[model samples]
Target: MPDRVYLDWNATTPLRPESRAAMTAAFDLVGNPSSVHAEGRQARRVIEEARESIARVLGAAPRNVVFTSGGTEANVLALSPGLRAPAGPVERLLVSAVEHASVLAGGQFDRKELSTIPVTPSGVVDLERLRAMLAGGPPALVSVMAANNETGALQPISQVAEQVRQAGGILHVDAIQAFGKIPFNVSELGVNLATVSAHKIGGPKGVGALMLGAGIEGPAALLRGGGQERGRRAGTENVSGIAGFGAAVKAAMAALDADLARVGSLRDRLEAGLRQTTGVVVFSSDAPRLPNTTLFAAPGMKAETAVIGFDLAGIAVSSGSACSSGKVQPSHVLEAMGASSALAQGAVRLSLGWSTGPEDVDRCLEAWRKLSLSLLKRSGETELERF
Candidate 1:
C-alpha cells in the first residue's frame, strides 16, 4: 500500500490536511443545530461559517448555497420542475449524452419526457443540435455537466446557457468534476443552478452544495423533515462534514492556479509516454479538457484487464467513472463520443491531483509500458495461432 501510486483523483481526492483538521474540531462540538439553546447557537455558527466560506469561494450568496448529501442529491434537488426563473415549470428534461449516471438517469422526470443531446467526436455538446432540440420542445430543463467525468471533456456550457436562456428554459450545470479543476462562476456561466461535491475536491464525502443563482427560487424540498437548509433540504446537518467541505474549498481555491499548472504538466508527460506505444488513442484529445485528466486506450486491450494489470503493478487507475467502474461495461461517455464498442471497452482514465508529483507520473508510465507490451504480445500470439 505504501508503494501504491494513485492516479484516480477525479473519482475522489485524498482528504486535505485543512479539511481533516476542521472536521476534527467540528467533531468535538456537541449540540443540535436546530435547538434554541446556546450549544445550538454554537452548532449553528459552525454551519453558517462553513456556508459563508464555500459561498465566498463560489461567488454566491450564502443564502443560495444548499448543502446536500453529495453531488447526486444536489443534482436531484436541482432537477425539480418549477425551480427556474419567469414563473413556469420545466415540462421536460434534456441532458448531454455523456453526463454522469446520476444526470443520465433523468432525475424527477418520467422516462418518456427525457431526451439526450448528442456530443461531438471530441465529446463536446452539439450546440446546433441543441438549438434544434430547444426549438422543438417546451421550456425544458437542460442539464449539462461542466466537464465529463470519464473523458474530462469540457462542455460548451456558456454557449449552451445562452441558448437555454433564449429559449425560455432553465440550465442546470453539473460542476462536480469541474469545481476545483477549473475556474467557473454560476452567474458568469449564466446557469440557473449548479451542483458541486466536496469529496472530489479533497473534502469529506457525503457533503456537497447546490448553488442557486440570484433571484432564482430553488426546487421544493427533496427531504422535508427538520426544515433545514432553509427548507431546501430537510435533515440534521452533517456538521463535521460541512466544516471539512468549507475548509477544502478555501484550500483548493488558494492553490488552484499553481495546482493546475503542475498537474497539467504531469498529465501531458503521462499522455506523451502512453502515446509511445502503438494503437493507443486518447479520448477528447482535441477538445478543451481538465488540466489533470487523460482517457486513453489501446485497441485489443481490455480495460478490466488493464485496470487489474495496473493494480498488480501497484498503480491505481480506473476504467471509467468510479460509480460505474465495478460494472464490466463499455463507457457511455466514450460511446456518446461516437467511439466503437471496442474502443469504449478498452478506455482507461488517469486523473491527477494537487498532490501528484513527477515520480507518480513516472511510476504510472512504467506500469503502462509493461501492460501495453504484454497485451501486444498476447495479440501477436493469437494472430499467429490464427495463421
Candidate 2:
C-alpha cells in the first residue's frame, strides 16, 4: 500500500513544520500567562507575540483578537448577549442556510425566531432576499460564513456586512474556510465579529480566534472562570497552540498567492477528471470558490460507499460537512442550493491544501475512476434520478 492521499483539507489541514516547531518551542516555557511573576510575564509575552502575528496576518488590531478553544466557542461567544440587553426580549438571530453545524448548534440564538437567508444555486447568498428580510422587521444580528465549507462557494460578506451595518445590525462571519486560504481584512469585510480556526490553516486543532472590531462589544461570557482573553473568554491561554497558530498564519500570508495558484490548478484537474465520468455534476462550479475545493456528485452512487471506496484506495474524501460526517443526513449546504435529497445523497467533497501536490491530485482522480465504475456496476444503473 501507499501513503493515504488526503483530499479532506476542507475538514482540517496537517500541521505545517513551522507550526510544529513553534509549538515545540512553546512547550518548554513553564509559566501561567495570568500570573504576575517573571515566569508569568514571559508566558504573557509569548501569548501577546502570537496575538500580534495573527492580527498582522488577518489585517486586524492585536487588541481585537480573543483566543478561544476553537471556532465553535468563538462563534458562540460572539453571538451571546452582552451585559446591556433589556430584560424579557431576545435578539433576532439571522443565520444563512449553509452554516456549519457548529454555528447551527451553538444555541446562542432563539430557535423560534431564527431567520434563514436563502442562497442562490451558485451558493452565494440571495442579497435581494436578505435586504427584504432586513427591511421586513427590526434590525437583527446576522451570521454568514465567508465561504461555504462543503461547496467552497465564496460569499459576498463585504457587501452583506455593509447592509447589516446600515441596518444597525452586527455581522458575524464564520471565516473558518476563508482566513488563510483567501485574503481576510477584518476592516475591509466590515464585520463586527469574525471566527477563524487554526486547524483549517495548518495549525493545531484546538486553537482558534474570535476577532472583534474596535469599540464593538459582544455578548456575555460562555465560559465563567478566571478572567482571560481580556475578560472575554475565560480560560488558561493555550500557549503552545497559539504559538503554532501564529506561525501557521504568518507562513500562510507569505505563501498565499503561490499556494492558491498551485492548489487551484490541482482542483481544476480533479474536477475535470471527475467530469469525464457520466452523470457527474460539480456543485458550485459556476461560482467563485475557494481555490482548493471541489464538490461533485456521482449519480447512482452512495456517498458513504464512495467514501469507503476512496478510503480503501488510499484516498481520503468527505460526503459533506466534516462536522456532520458520522450522521446520515444529506448536506444542508447542497440542499440549500436546490439539490434534491437524492442529488445531495451522492455528493462528495475533495479539498486540497498547502501541502497538496500534483501526485496527490492524480492519485485521487484515479481512485475516483475505479470507485465510480464499481459503484455504477453495483447499482445496475448509469444515471441517478433528477429532482
lDDT winner among the candidates?
A: 1
With a 3 Å backbone cut-off (N, CA, C), the pairs that clash in candidate 1 are: none
Every candidate's CA RMSD: 2.8, 3.1
Instruction: Give the runs in model 2 whose Cα sits over 4 Å from its true position.
Output: 83-90, 321-327, 382-387
Q: In model 1, which runs have C-alpha deviations exceeding 4 angstroms?
A: 321-327, 381-387
Deviation in Å, model 1, residue 283 alpha carbon: 0.4
Question: lDDT score of model 2?
Answer: 0.84
Quality of model 1 by C-alpha lDDT: 0.87
Q: Candidate 1: TM-score?
A: 0.96
| TM-score for each predicted model, relative to the true structure | 0.96, 0.94
lDDT of 2 by residue, 20-76 (tens): 999999899999999999999988998998899888876789988999999988888
List model 1 lDDT by residue over 1-387, tens digit each. Answer: 788999999889999999999999999989999998998888889899989987776678999999999999999888877665453678889999998888888887788889999999999999999999999667788999999888899998999999999888889999999997799888778988899999999999999999988877668787988889989888899999999999998899999999989999999999988887767899999999999999998768888888999999998899852335556677888878889988788889999998899999998888887788787577662331110
- Candidate 2 clash pair list: 80-219, 81-219, 81-220, 82-219
